[model samples]
Target: MKKYLLLSAFATLTLLSCNNEGTSVNNTVESMKTPAMENFDKAFKSLGDPQNRPTEEEKKRNTSELSDRRKALLVPASKELILSLGVTESELMRKTGGDMSQIIVWATQIYMKKSDEIRKNIKSEK
Candidate 1:
């Protein structure tokens, strides 16, 4: 009876430890967002603001075009995100031709690539 009790206690401890390990890994991934990732997330999320969203008329007018006002809203955050990724102002201008949309797109691509690399590293570590 004592041996059976000891085995049950050991099994409980082993299961608890395994559960804690999974939670810790999830916590690590959640905490691993770099500043650049934060900035990129912020820049994209800005468009979800009511003031930033295009009205029906505006959308009908030109679905492909972002108005100057909308561009104004995105430019600062987008520039910050791009610069955080080690891109110089001159290099950004040369690469994006001073287009706010292009800057955002380029930054998003970089963000996705970096995110993929992080995920790959985490998977490999496990």
Candidate 2:
């Protein structure tokens, strides 16, 4: 009886977790329609394609694109703010985790998303 009760409890918990996961996915998909999400989608797509993954050159290129976007969008004024928030140039470089090229690609995506938020706030203010 104890075993049966435990099994039932586990099943219930599993079902609840699955339901929550479904809801989260739905919400995430809905949220992806935003401009920031669109940029994220593009950045990730450009970086994560399997063909891009295998070649060092492609990976480096992707990282360069990300860094460029971060610079272009955020400009110099936001550098301190971004650094204070823990997304500093050094931190981003660290994120590459020794994979020199992949580091660049991922960091760019991170900054791009941040820039999108800043832009959104500016728009809201005006």
Candidate 3:
């Protein structure tokens, strides 16, 4: 009877823990978002949309047009912020090779680090 009681308690706790996992994950993700993430999301969205993608025909026949399109993928705000951080536009374009995902990753890392510094300074000032 004691063994049976312990088993049921363990099973109940396990089930309750499982139910909390989804909420915990969502809360964590929500808390992690910052204004800098907006730029990352915008670039990612433009890259992810099929309609915004360069066609295979364009890749083959109109490489210059494709390059221009890829360059344009970086929104002006993002471009300005990234450039202000001392990363040259050409260097970023070369590093990302027109991959928005890469740019998103790079920009998010830069922004998050800078944001952390700003927060630290604000707290220290207080």
RMSD of each: 4.8, 12.1, 8.0
Query: What lDDT does candidate 2 reach at residue 75?
Result: 32
Can you give the lDDT of residue 87 in candidate 3?
Answer: 84
Please report, in order, the local distance difference test score of every candidate based on alpha carbons: 0.80, 0.54, 0.66
Would you estimate the TM-scores of all the predictions? 0.69, 0.31, 0.43
Candidate 1's TM-score reads 0.69
Return the candidate ranking by lDDT, descending. Answer: 1, 3, 2
Give candidate 1's whole-model lDDT: 0.80
Query: What is the full ranking by TM-score, best candidate first?
Result: 1, 3, 2
Superposed Cα deviation of residue 93, candidate 2 (Å): 25
Model 3 Cα lDDT, one tens digit per residue, 1-126: 999999999999999998897667555554554544556556657866897787786677854433446546654545555666678879989987856556655776776776576556555754
Error of 1 at 14 (Å): 13
Q: Which stretches of candidate 3 lie over 4 Å from their true place?
A: 1-16, 61-66, 80-126
| Candidate 2 regions with alpha-carbon error over 4 angstroms | 10-22, 25-33, 54-126
Model 2 C-alpha lDDT per residue in residues 1-126, reported as the tens digit of each score: 999999999999999999997787556555645454445446456545553443555456755344444433323333333344557687745654544345444545555676577557555754
Give the candidate number with the greatest lDDT: 1
**lDDT value for candidate 2?**
0.54
